[model samples]
Target: MSLLVLLFAVIPITEMLAVRLFSGIITDGPGQFAANPLRVVWQIVVFFLALAVTRSAHHLIKIVRVRVFRSGFQAAGSGVPPNKESWQWAVAFEMSNVSSAVVQIAMFAALFFAFDPITGIVGAVVAAASLAAISWLYQRQLRLQRDYLETRWTPEAVAIPDRVGTRIKHSEIGAFVGTAGLLVTLIVVFARVLGGQIVTSDAIVLFLGLRLMFGQFGTLSSGAMRFARAAVHL
Candidate 1:
C-alpha cells in the first residue's frame, strides 16, 4: 500500500514537472507563435493529471474502509473477519469515489470556464463540501449495517488501540492540510515566476485532489504500522 501511494504521488509530480518544463520551452522559443497547435495538447495533459487524482481518491477510500473494518472487528468478531470485510468496504468506497470525482471535475470545469479565480475557488469549496457530505452519509449507513450484524453474531468484543485509529486520523489530517498548503504556495510562486495567467481555479481543484490522495496514502500506510505495533506490544 505504501508503494502504491508513493507511485501515485510521485508519478503526477513527475508528469506535471515534465509538462511544465516542456510548456516553458514551447512558449519561450523564437517561433513560439507557430507552436500554437490544437488545445488537444492541454486536454491530454489534464486528462493524465485527472487520472492520477482519481487513483489517489480511490486509494483513500480504501484506507478509510480498512480502518473501519479493523475497528468493527475489534469491537465484535461478528461473522466476517475484519480484514476481509474491510476489503469489501474498500471496494464499495472506491466505486463511490469514482462517481464523486467525475461529478467534481465536471462541476469544477464548468465553474472555471464561467467565472474568475475567486468565484471558482468558492464553487470548488462548495462542491468539495457536497462530495464529503455524501460520502459521510454513505459511511454512516454502512456503520448501521455493521452494528446490526455485530449484534446478531455477538462475537467477543475487544478494545481497539488508540494508536490503531487515532494516529492514522491525525496523519491523514496533517498530510491533507500540509499538502494543500504546499500546493497553494507553489501556485503562488509559479504565478509570480510565470505570470498570473497560470492562476486558474482549475489548478485549485487539481491541488485539492492531490492533497486528498496523499492523505489517503498516509492513512493506509499508517494502518499496517499500527498492526505491527499491536503485535509487538502483545
Candidate 2:
C-alpha cells in the first residue's frame, strides 16, 4: 500500500544485494579493490535515481487509475450506482504496471551495472525479453480497461447476503509468509551451491522474496477489498 516503503527500503536493499552478488561472480581482476569505492558510490547514486523514477511512476499510475475510473463512471452516466468492483479491478490492473516496470528496471539495472553476465549477448537478450514482457502486460491491461469502458458492461444483481466468507482461515496469512520464507531459503541455497557466490547471491535471493511478497500483498489486499465491498450490502 505504501510505495514509499518499496522505494526507500526494498529498492535500495535489493540493489545493494545485486551489487554485492555481481561483484563476486563477475570479477574484473585485482583492480576491483581500487575501484570498489567508486562502484559503491555509483550504485548508491543509481539506487536513489531508481527510487525517484519508481516513486514518480507509482504516483502517476494512481492518478491515471483515478482519472480513468472516474471517466468510466461518467461515461456510464452519473445516475448509475458505482461499480466499485470494476474500479477495484482497475486499481489492481494499474498496480501491475508499477510492479512489472519495477521488476524490469531493477533486473536490467542489476544485469548491466551490478553483475556482469556470462556473456554480453545473454544479458542483452534477457533484459530485452524481460522488459518487453513487462511492457506488453502494461499495455494489455490498459486496452482491456478501454474495451470494458467502450462497452459499458453492467454488474449483475446478486441476492447473496453481504457477509465475509467464513471459510477463509486465519492461518492463511501464516501459510503465505511461511511459503515466502521457504522460497528465499531455496533461492539462496541454489545460488550458493550453483553460482558459488555467498553474500551477493543471498542478497539477490532476498530481493526476489521482496518482489514476490509485494505481489502477494497486492493479491491479498484485492481479496480483502472484495470482502469489504460485499459487506457494504449489509
Candidate 3:
C-alpha cells in the first residue's frame, strides 16, 4: 500500500513537477510545453495510471503463483497424480511479464509521441530496442521455468542458492545500462536547454547501448548451470 502511494502519488507528482519545469529539455523546446501544458499534464496522469495498473497486475500474478503452489501441495497430499504447479507457474509468469510489457509500451508511446515527428521517430526506435531486450530476457526466463518445473529434482534436495537463477541476470545489466543512458540523456537534454545546443549522435548511441545492455542482462541468470534441464526457470 505504501509502495503504491509512493509510486502513484509521490513519484508521479514529483516527476510531473520536474517535467513541467524542465519540459523544454525533454520535449526539445520551450515552445513545446508553452503551447501544450494540458498535454504534459495528461501524459503525467497516464504514466501514473499505468504504474497503478502494473502494480495491480503484479498482485494478480502473485495470487496465481500462490495458487500454483497450493495445487502442488494438494497433489502431494492426495497422491493421485504429479502436481502441475510447474506448468501453471510458467504460464502465470509469462502472463505477468506480458502485462508489464504492455504497460511499458503504453507509457513509452505516451512520452515518445509527445515530441515532434522527427524526434518521435528516434524515440520510438530507442523505446522499441529497450523493450526488445526485455522481451528476450523474459523469453529465456520462461524457458528456464519450464526446465526447472519438469526436472526430477525435488525442492528438499536442492539448496536455495542453487535455485536462484535459471535465466539471465537482466535486471543488473539493465540497471547498469539504464543508469548510463539516463546520465547521457540527462546531459544532452540539459545541454540543449542551458547552452542552446542541438541533439547529438552521442545521445542516440547511449540509447542503443542502454537497450542492448538491458537485453543481455534480462536473459542471463547466475545459477542456471547447477540445475538440470528439467528444473524451473528462475
As for lDDT, the candidate ahead, 1 or 3, is 1
Over 1-234, each residue of candidate 1 has an lDDT whose tens digit, in order, gives 343344334433433444443444444433543566445456446656656665675566556655654566567755755556655455434533343333333443343434246434643554454335434433443453344435544654323453235435543543454345445534543554356554433354434433443334333333333333332222
Local accuracy of candidate 3 as per-residue lDDT tens digits, 1-234: 223223323322333333333433355444555888777666657656655664564465456555655666577673323475464444444443444334343443344334323333444455556555555554565565565566638753434455464232444544444344344444544454456443443234334333433232232222122222223432
Instruction: Estimate the lDDT of model 2.
Output: 0.43
Stretches > 4 Å off in candidate 2: 1-33, 82-162, 165-234
RMSD of 3: 9.8
* lDDT, candidate 2, 20-84, per-residue tens: 44444344424554767676556556656655665665566556655655666567664534666
Error of 1 at 16 (Å): 1.5
TM-score of each: 0.29, 0.42, 0.42
Query: What's the CA RMSD for each of the models?
Result: 13.5, 10.6, 9.8
After TM-score superposition, what is the CA distance of residue 231 in candidate 2 from its true location, in Å? 11
For model 3, the run of ten residues with the poorest summed lDDT: 219-228
The list of candidate 3 runs beyond 4 A from truth reads 1-101, 115-119, 154-159, 166-168, 194-234
